[model samples]
Target: MAHVDPSAPLEGKASKETERKLKRESRTQIVSFVFMVFITTTAFLTVASDVIPSGFAIPFILLLASVQVIMQLYYFMHMNAKGTGWVNALIWGGLFVAAMTVAALMLLIGITKY
Candidate 1:
């Protein structure tokens, strides 16, 4: 038996299905990256420009941030892939708990005036 070098490059053309899948994945990643960059730019502009009032700008920027986070998780992190139902549920549950905790804290702070 001969030993195979793991570091060596693959020697043959990939199957059609594999090539198609790769192309689709690459396209998705590129689109997601571009969209994230656009979101970042929008957030920067929102903060930099004085035309948009703070009252509106703050929430708008936060909304954009949330969108970016979701996109990052689903696209960059591969959370949208198949067979990740349990992982998805756990992550979403965690996020829900964190959001609730923050809300509760904010309420307490408001009530205590601290």
Candidate 2:
């Protein structure tokens, strides 16, 4: 058998691939963070100012909040990474159930009659 080098530099193809992957992840995280901040500021301004009506602002802010939650889950929680298939399935299923429950409640409350 041949002796192995103990002090070899980690500069092979695998290292390069990992470096590129890290760079791409960093860029995506930065972009997502900026988007989250923008959404938050927009929501705050919408509520602080009288430009948008309350009825429109509420729904708009809710939509933005949901988008922000999705971003947080995918980026911060790494839900899009490998080996997270089951986690994704569970989270999405929970969301579906919650949405259905809310829809049922809304229907019972006669929201469409307004």
Pick the TM-score winner: 1
lDDT of 1: 0.95
lDDT of 2 by residue, 1-114 (tens): 297787887564657888999899899999999999999999999999987899999999999999999999999899989999999999999999999999998898897676
The window of 10 residues in a row where model 2 has the poorest summed lDDT is 8-17
Pairs of colliding residues, candidate 1: none
User: Local error of candidate 1 at 59, Å?
Assistant: 1.6
RMSD in Å for candidate 2, one decimal?
6.6
Best by lDDT: 1
Model 2 spans > 4 angstroms off? 1-14, 100-114
With a 3 Å backbone cut-off (N, CA, C), the pairs that clash in candidate 2 are none
Q: Write the per-residue lDDT of candidate 1 for residues 1-114, one digit (tens) a residue.
A: 299899889799999999999999999999999999999999999999989999999999999999999998999999989999998999999999999999999999999995
Clashes of 2: 0
